[model samples]
Target chain A: MCGIVGLLVKTPALKARLGELMVPMLIGMTERGPDSAGLAVFTEPLATDERKISLYSGLTEEGADFNWLGLGHELKAHLGIEARMAVQGNHAVLTIGIAPEPVKRWIKEHHPRLHILSTGRAIDLYKDIGTPTEVAERYDFKHLTGTHLVGHTRMATESAVTPDRAHPFTAGEDFCLVHNGSLSNPYGVRRMLEPRGIKFETDNDTEAACRFLEWRLREGDDLETALQKGFAELDGFYTFLMGTTDKLALIRDPFACKPAVVAENDEYVAIASEFRSLAHLPDIKNAKVFEPAPEEMYVWTA
Target chain B: MDSLKFDLAEIPLRTVNTFLHQEAPGQGVRKVLITNPDGAHNIAVGLDFPVEIEIVGHAGYYAGGMNKQASITVTGSAGTGVAENMMSGRVHVKGFASNGAGASAHGGLLVIEGDAGLRCGISLKGGDIVVGGSVGSFSAFMAQAGRMVICGDAGDALGDSLYEAVLYVKGSIKSLGADARIEPMAEADLATVKALLAAAGPAFDQYAPQDFKRVASARSLYHWNADANQEY
Candidate 1:
């Protein structure tokens, strides 16, 4: 009982309407996952010296009324860097001209409860504890513009239904993964990754998968090779959909215990756990729709 | 004698299903047209009236389950369990089908013009399936009776731990399950493939009867081997 959705527009013109098209797709899976929903959209890249961090204040004491401007000024006075921000409800994207590690450390030290969703040059993530429609409306997902995005609706079988535990789990930078099945050996994976200086944010099993794959990417293994290692190390019934700055990759477990359907055309590639989420797309009748085979990686470039 | 039409976009699924269950038999609506199926689950399920259902678009899980004396056709793909536990009549899909396409069916015929997903006919009591495209792993697992004709390749463990149900495949098999072996196709097996292919419609007209190989149980696992220490 989880739902995963990913969309990457091949035609640059279609990027403007990307979020608008994805709203219905996310809402359609509300039945499969009604507890919480989230997504990470990959927009145009930032300047070479700049990076952006997606911050969530839902777990904070101030909630939606958190003073984002004060945080920007604090960064300027304390860290000697100006931070430009775009705030929406409890979520905000803070773009800065410094590495995200120290900025993240500052936020962790000062605003301990503020959850960092993601930090990258091209990705802006938003997730919260609500229905898919509520979360989409909360973040105004319909107005988002990007080349691609990965979204998820979770029913919370393996972890508590908290804002931080909701999916599109990110690790390292500019990478995220959403899962639709449970892992049998998440503790084993965590034990393996923890020894290598990787830190975990939540006890959710999907985080382990997200961090494991990203750690591999950081180690210079290409996406396909890392996934091959994943096939050997990860043991579970999973259909994991991963998002990078330039690609959207999907894979099902050997048994395909979880489902994924891919619909592709000249303009875009859309993936969902079921066809219900994709029936509203334009020219869906002519789309080359098919089910990705088990243990096979299908990667689409944006 | 016009066909009955139901646009799922405007009318709720419960309304359409209610009509088929309560009012359709008495009204003599021989044909039912469902428009914009949009991967909606349980469309035209549990029918008893021998009515002809034409789904104009993709249907979700269990599109035509537990059917009796009905003919259902999906113009697009079908989700998991397209025709599970069907009692009689025919259910056909013009496009690909998700996992467990015709699982545990009792009688009647199920046809897929495209690929069928994993465990397509698991735990089948009886029924017949004809897949024009490939079938995923573990198809026809533990099937007790009836027949299956796959015009394309089969994934790993084609018919593991089978029981009486026979399988005919035209293409390569990734692997066969325990006790399920490719036996010499007898004259009866060829005739069965011929009849099933014809029943599956024109899309299967190209597959000759002799082109298929028969897979059935070796009956090795039928009884417990007390002397063989946990090895099959």
Candidate 2:
């Protein structure tokens, strides 16, 4: 079983402590998932023309000493675009002025081993192969400031424990999903999406679901409509938690084979696979704690 | 007898459970107060005594599992399998409960003051369950013997394949499983609901025994028909 946690702060003041508040929530699920940990946080958006790409150099040869500024300069020279990067250990968030397709392709061409974690105006993602505590310390998750975040701890069942295979899987941009239950027909869903030109990143089942839902959203289906289709086509036991630019959405399969508990107050809305992960939240005693029903869509806006 | 206190914030749950298992009885303790449970799993499990355990906060998985004579009470919500596989005693939750709330119990009274998630009393050998609120899908599947009193609605597939176990539901039932049918409630069913509701608590007293409907199995799957070509 994997662990999924999400926190959406309604009060603007609580946004400053988003990541700090989520650290305990993520670490609390250590018993459920102990292999790898990851999170996607939606921060203040950048300019309309600028898109930030979160890159992980953990698998690179140089590892922690990977040259992020050097890549920025190379991008400036090759693509004639000013790229500003915030270097953090093996992870970096690089902001580029031009469109992201060429820059992403260039990065893939030059640094094939470097994994692109996410790309969007509001999202900066970090995921790695380690325990939740180690991963949180490595990325300094406590210092991150955002309106909302989705975190995951992995207990590998259907796939290997690679950083790219870790959760908060992204599809187009600003859209991420974490799954708890296993999908019975991921390959069938893959065949359905591959013919439509959706290239998969990993053989993991959760990625297939993530891409399918995001592709539906990109195909002009509203969130609710796309999720209705997801309920129809995606055949498996899943409690999916998705995060977009301004919304956090959740849905369970028809059977709700997986577990999920939600706690909401005037200040924040927190979700976890179990109540243990959310026990440490402030004022949680007064929160409206409840379990989400099967085949029901729950959405919260920032 | 003096009541003992165990603060989970400062002490590990093992110490409390060990005390309950090893020394609480010898010390003449009849009551236990557990504070800051914080949804920790296995708060007071495997008790063979008649001591009363009061958990001040939420409890995690299997809070009162395998109980013999102990009476456990949680002031807040309980996680999955709160009183699963209980032999005898009483488990009470003041708030809602997660999946498989009272699964496969042999004997005891499991009370959820609020709702209970999917498969509330699956595979029950013999036990009594009183749900003050709704119960999710697949409640009381494949029960050998026991009874359940549901004050609120029930989700899909209530009592799929049952044996001698009866369910009294006051609210609507979404669907009934195969071989399960709604029959007229006799005087015995009403009396059972009355006794179970009174045992549940005063809050459940508002629900009258006559308001409930009885659901039981048709016993069609008791004997197989080989000549029918494997169709139900």
All DockQ scores:
0.89, 0.75
* Each prediction's whole-model lDDT (CA): 0.94, 0.92
Sequence-dependent TM-score of model 1 = 0.99
Q: Which portions of model 2 show Cα errors greater than 4 Å?
A: B229-232
TM-score of chain A of each: 0.99, 0.99
Stretches > 4 Å off in candidate 1: none
Docking class of 2: medium
- Deviation (Å) of B5 in candidate 2: 1.1
Per-residue C-alpha lDDT of model 1 across residues A173-239, encoded as one tens digit per residue: 8999999999999999999999999999999999999989999999999999999999998999899
- Model 2 C-alpha lDDT per residue in residues B27-133, reported as the tens digit of each score: 87889999999989998999998899999988999999988899999999999998999999999999999989889999999999999999999998899999999
Model 1: which residue pairs collide?
none
Error of 1 at B51 (Å): 1.0
**Alpha-carbon RMSD of each model:** 1.0, 1.0
